[model samples]
Target chain A: MNPEQLNSPNDFQTIVNKIYQNEQFDFVGIALQSSEAPHSIKWDFVAGNTNERFRKIVLRSGIGIAGLVVRTGKPFWDNNLNHYEFSDEMYTPIAKTESLRSAVAIPIISPLTNLVRGVLLAGYRSNKIKISGQTALTLSQYL
Target chain B: MLETTRWINNYFNDSTDAIMIFKDDELILSNQIAKDLQNELELNPQYLVEVADSSVKQKFSPTDNCFSCIIQNKMKEISIPITLAKNMPHPLNYFMIYNVIDQNEKVFSLTLKNRGTIDRMDQLAQQRKLTQYVNRAHEKERKRISEDLHDSIAQGVYSAIMGVRRLENNHFTAEEIKELTTVIESQLNDTLTEVKEMALDIRPSVLDNFGLLAALKVLAKRLEENSGVTINVAGNANTEHLSDDIQSVLYRITQESINNALKHANADEITVLLVAHNHYITLEIMDDGDGFDVPKYQHFNGKSMGLMNMNERVKTFNGAFKMESKSGEGTTITVKFPVA
Candidate 1:
């Protein structure tokens, strides 16, 4: 599996849909940094998103959920968004826009460079889902 | 007699101290100053003698006649010792003139003065200044460690990874040796990545290298990605002209405010704006989330360390901090620093 082949936006969308179907998540998406504007990252592909607002949101390297994964190259998950320690102001924007109640974000690391190339997010809108480390490992296998 | 009375009236009226005349425990005369003093102390002038006598007795000894002894003393100006309530802004000091008008009259002239309050306030201000200094030192250390990690340890790890990768091609001839080298190389790369992340988390190198705006852009971008929250940063302030300390404090305040909003607010969006003008810089963070009770959160014991830390950081540089929020409304934090 060539890294470039997996990097295609369409291929990512297909993968996102598969993850959403397999995991029974309410929302699934992939955000990749633009090559021309490396600092600017956007959700290039999504499946089961509540609205189109997430697609229009342009993220910077350290700004939001996907940006955090991209910035640190680490996976993060919140079993319950409401119970999480993050400020409501930071997550409410996307949580409300997408109606996500719980979520997990995994960074896709490029093996050659050992750098995060994208983030894969899976979540629910109304129900709480405890996305454990095993779930992240399973998702990473697809990448 | 009329002339003497007029002279006493003029003296009582002209005197600045809160003066009251007591003829054998009877409130005979009190000046306007005395009335004003009573009002300020929230006391009743009608019972001034009884109140003072009881308070003095309670402070000294229940059986002692300290108040009467002071009044009976023959000294022209005798000081009456009394203890003020702990919460009172000023300690009460009183002086009495014994037999001022006539030897047989037994009239006592009492004067009240406030001098201890101002001294106590000055002491409190000094303690606050010392606390601010300690906070500044703490922040400085955090910045130093962040810089050290980014400049020294992370860079060293990168070089070591490169060196180890080069060894895999030339030195490891056996297949098993080559495989072991590959495992070691991968572990070292993981350590390098961890070190880099730790450096950024401690303090972003971009903050020191560029300035506040660039640093904020990086923070906002990453926060948005990790939380799926929308954060908009708009500012044209050239932080390069500002001192490193001011820039660091502002960056930290911005970071903490964003973190607070994300973890607690359940908000939809956050907007940060920065402006510099006329030797002053203003930074504002606004969030459209479920706002909190500002006073309650501020006073809530140990629950708002983040807010307190932000306030202390701003105070270190003599900046003004303001936060406004209400339940179901939203929250906004603004800080202003004088660059000049």
Candidate 2:
């Protein structure tokens, strides 16, 4: 499609929603480090039947699940928040807001400079899940 | 007199109390009490003599050396009340001696009581002491295990994730390989999340790093997200100022309370308030969920250690813990501790 077609938040959300339509995933969203808003990472686009709470969450770098992945340049995931333990303060806000039982976030890097500038977040509300290599590559491909 | 003497001899033979007669610093008459009491001292006989000299002479009086005799002695009795020294085996006793002239100034002496019970009780208390030591060792072990997982294992997982990213740069074809790579990525992502969650649950880095406010806020947010319950949390206390140990206790207690509410109480709304007033920090968790009879589920049986565990944490800081609930109302747990 046109590059301008993917320019807006709705467009991004529409595209992501179509991609994961048949998948078992519960929610799929994209977060980019916003230069317009404090230069920290924020969830710019979200798709799927999401709670109104997600809209109010303006994430900082290393603050929530997406923020941690984007800031640390690493992918993070957990199936059960209650069962799995985390020591960092960064993920607490994300864990609380999303009610995400099992979820993963992979850092998305620029294809040219290989510089991580965003993250792809996918999660399920049921059991704990582990993101495999193939799923990680698929996520990278989409980005 | 002979019959009495025989009974005295028999009784004295088995008794552990010191029974002796002294004549001019000579042990003229000694019973099993002497052997028992002497062995219990665990000190040089010379020390006993010195102690006796210092005490007996000071308390001694001219005519009172007999039954009414006043013997100068500073050797005060050491006994744990509610228990007998000889019978309990926990205390050691002693008997001093002083010379008394019998009719012809023969330098005959009377025996002063000194009985010790420590050796007897040592054997009994050994098991108790051992169990206590083991419990302490186990507590330290738990802490160490939690720390190692947080520091080493969690860090290792993060590093491996970075290494996986390094592999992504390679040219990959074959739909199968690409698919396999995605699977690997998901597995790593899952593992990383699990590791982080484990570390946080055991001991949150926020509680360790920024303090209780940040941690509690995180906890409150989580309760809201998962249960679809709106948890409004507000705290005026300086959570960052609380001691790390206290912070952990509060964090754990809050965790258990929230978990219990989620699992048992089908509550729709929960509110947490933490405030510092008059040198005490107070935390209250109130839920408008389905409440239950407080006395019905009060036992700390094996099934649910939730309240029991929270009680233990509160007790560690000499704090007060109270929970209130009703069949149809809801449950509220309040914990308070001094700002030590």
Candidate 3:
């Protein structure tokens, strides 16, 4: 809730872990854009991740789902990502590397700037997901 | 023999060389191609004087033994490629450099050669050019369809919404009906926005009315506003010489490169510079991000399609596409196209 609350990596990891445990998601992750490089958002804390590929993933604003969330400051959800028409740059590398099918991304507002400095995403590896905008609204309240 | 001569004439000055003489900035004498090219000459390769300031550099000269250095201390000559006319190969020019003769005298001659004479490969190049022609036709259709959506459908939707709004002004309308009308109005507004965005994606209209320079500046500004990324576009060039297809191709290449920088490279900033000389137009795109291995990622799955499309478009126009990237460093793409 405060700036100091998320100062430590352990604190961020615990938050991601708590959300992953509280919510029924196949995978959950928190991607942060550092002030040093505000354009790049890197997934720092992830729970229930299949591999370490998410760690290596770097996303720019308006590119991937997390990046889009950070850029737009709005939740993005898609049941059939492959069917949707997206920009050519909308690759969603995390979803591909993690084998995630359905995903929901929510903006994480910084207490300091009152602006979106990070993105929290919950994804499902299953082919079908009953998730909707309503689910994203509920998930967003968790933060 | 006639066909051969015509084919040769299509690319060269009677299959020989177009020669010209330049004393400082003044044109003394020139052949047909050189005369045609003289009109478009802006920057007169002033660097030739700088290089001449040192010593003359030559590519390879057989006439070196014939000419004596008795006239001007040393017979100075520099052979370089210069484009005399559009849609023609850059002729390797032989310029006889000299000192700035008193206010009236420094005289230098420029000899232009046909660079290449590959008649056998003409048909193959034409076949590739045909493929590019087909691709361009598809994009033109897209532009037409985009215009239809913007002008016709979007306008129709607007009038229909206006009709609905006017109908709601009547006192006979019930509360439920009014709410339904409001819903319909909002739905129509959403459709209008979506249609406008789709039309923009199909083909930006600014690219048509304004030239590539203005269009690129607008695109960079819009993208930078959408995302917090720093995108700077800088350069000045006369886009009139470029054909519609080549201009579109160049714009697409720049757009795709910027997108790639944001998506793949995690770039924070991107800079694009476009410069055109008499012979060719050059576009340089640079991004500051954590770069990756270029060779390894060149063929990486679905993502490679974007790279392939960009490459194919450049090749379609006979442009040179060069990409340099290092892991953790950054990526830079430099593209050069012959005026032809």
**lDDT: which candidate is best?**
1
Candidate achieving the largest TM-score: 1
Which of 1 and 2 is the better model by lDDT? 1
Query: Candidate 2 on B1-340: residue-level lDDT in tens?
Result: 9999999789877654555555555556667756665566543444444454544553554444543222223323311112114454565344444444463544443343433354556655754655665687579669866875765456546754764665576564564344434434433453455466556756688787777878888877755543445778888888766777888888888887877786667566778888998789999999877788876666544434567667767998899999999878999999999885
lDDT by residue (B1-340, candidate 3, tens digit) is: 9999888556555424555556765656556665554455432544444444443433233345434333334444444433333444643333332433344666765555454533336656755765675677678767767765665456547655664765567553375454445434533543554465455557877778888988888778655543446789999888977899888988888888887776666666799999998899999999988787778755424323566567767998899888998988899999999995
What are the interface RMSDs of all the models? 9.3, 11.2, 14.0
Question: Where does candidate 1 chain A have its weakest 10-residue lDDT segment?
Answer: A84-93
Scanning candidate 1 chain B in windows of ten residues, the lowest lDDT window is: B94-103
Best by DockQ: 1
Q: Scoring only chain A, what TM-score does candidate 2 earn?
A: 0.73
TM-score of 1: 0.52
Q: After superposing candidate 2, which stretches have Cα over 4 Å from the reference?
A: A1-8, A20-24, A34-44, A55-104, A111-113, A125-132, B1-231, B234-269, B274-283, B288-306, B309-320, B325-330, B335-340
Least lDDT summed over 10 consecutive residues: which range in candidate 2 chain A? Answer: A84-93
| TM-score per candidate, chains pooled | 0.52, 0.43, 0.41
List per-candidate RMSD values in Å: 12.4, 16.4, 18.0
Q: Per-candidate DockQ versus the true complex?
A: 0.11, 0.03, 0.05
Which segments of candidate 3 are over 4 A away from where they belong? A1-143, B1-199, B221-228, B277-279, B296-305, B315-318, B338-340
